[model samples]
Target: MAKDRFHPSSRGLSHHGMLPLFSHHPVVSEFHWDHSVWGSSWLFLIVSVLGYVISVQIVKMLLSFRRRPVPLGPIPALYNFGLLVASVVMFAGCLQSTMAEIAETRWLWQRSKTPFEWIICFPMGTRPAGRVFFWSYIFYLSKFYEFTGTFILLFQKQNLSSGHVIRNAMVVIMCFLWLQFAQSLQIFVLLSSTGLYITMYVYLSLCRMGYAPHFENALRYCQIAQYVSLLLASIVLIGLHYYKEGCSGMGAWLFGAFLDLSSLPFILVVNKQKKQRHVFNNTQKGSITSKTE
Candidate 1:
């Protein structure tokens, strides 16, 4: 048997002596996704996204007349640090919940004919709420919070997140469906991005604070590795979905996989070009120093 019935473990953050994000509370337990819930409807999602996109473009157009970037004192640094902390909490909560889910289901894996299949495949009728999904809901809400990052960038010279409205909307949609259909592997993807978000934003915060060790190359490599790793996982999920019976939310998962496939090439090419530019800049500096010597 490659499947087992689903039931979540009863545990909380108090069990780990950490933050209260893991507690058994009404907010998480009473939580349920539905069309009736706020931001759950297609119209709401479209309007929210379009509102952000239009608002941001309007601000940019208005800001273009200004000669210089606005200086918001320490706001950007504070913002990065704040997200750094939130990323830690999110990463911890999601990871803790994910491990709990997997561990609770370990017995099924042990008896399954396809052991690995169970990791990415949940049996039918699994409830879409619990500790993990609680944290997942927090993550879903955080998408809206992150939209502010682009607006924050509006004060800057060349930050590029302003162009990511569609991308952000897709993420919000994917995460919504993840909760809506109780998709398998969503935790895995969430963990990957949250982990990488911490890493990238840690570096960003440090750079903002005048830190010495800024390994741009290493960071770029890490970013690329995450995309590649998730892409591989997506491929594996696709294979398991068709061959190993089925996984919940395969339709939604396919969209996510296609999104990854489409984006990976662009990132690879962009990183390559960035690396070349970095190398060229360093070489030019070295030649200038040599001539001075």
Candidate 2:
């Protein structure tokens, strides 16, 4: 037998002999597409986008009403109410999801299993696990909402200075980018700690400068202090997390701490400063009238 011209296993060197472009390979098929998973992720993405848009628009409209000399009616109320409800719902969902991820990660870590392994293998790429991915997406959407709010404040000629604008913009952009790409818990915590500090500083500055109403100033100050304390606590917790659980765990902790500290001041301050300012003006008018008499 002529030494087999080619090993039996070696196919002839021909382009036509190459594997089919659309091989009916079972392994490839199974890995390529999973309808249920894809469908759910897609649906989540769609709802997220829609909710984000609605929230932004509502905020803009409400801010416009505040700035208008002749206030806009009924429509603004509807927008404001809708935006509030939507925001609360979205925030709740994000918190619930984040809590679930934390629990899962903790379980894996405690069991001496690789939690990051599941996260890494998720979505068949370096993409985070579903929980991480969803939360990260929500974080990005929240940043967009923040940016939109900032823009409205800028347009309304609100008390935000250039420094405030630059700082807040940087924080929001960094937050969005980090959540989208880094996905580490340590970085998340650090960013959040810094962001909350900056926010509190800016808000307090605005109150002190008389941008906010007088009665509200004290309350706003109190809120700023509270957030500052919270920021400090978060920073410490994040540091501990980094030491104990590596970067990813730290990141999740920081992200949460930042969010937790975000609205605390806003809620506490409300229009308290405005009320004080009104009282002061009344008192001043009375003094002037008494002098005139």
Report the C-alpha lDDT of model 1 over 46-115, residue by residue, as the tens digit. 7887888888889888888987888888888888887888889888877666555555555555655343
lDDT accuracy of residue 194 in candidate 1:
87
Q: Which prediction has the highest TM-score against the true structure? A: 1
- Candidate 1 backbone clash number: 0
Candidate 1: C-alpha RMSD to true structure equals: 4.0
lDDT of 2 by residue, 148-222 (tens): 544545344455434443444444444444433333442233333434434444444555456864443554565
Q: Which portions of model 2 show Cα errors greater than 4 Å?
A: 1-79, 102-105, 111-127, 146-160, 181-222, 249-283, 291-293
Candidate 2 — what's its lDDT?
0.42
Candidate 2: residue 8 Cα off by (Å) = 45
Model 1 bad stretches (over 4 Å): 1-23, 103-110, 113-116, 159-163, 276-293
Q: List the candidates' TM-scores in order.
A: 0.82, 0.45
Leading candidate by lDDT: 1
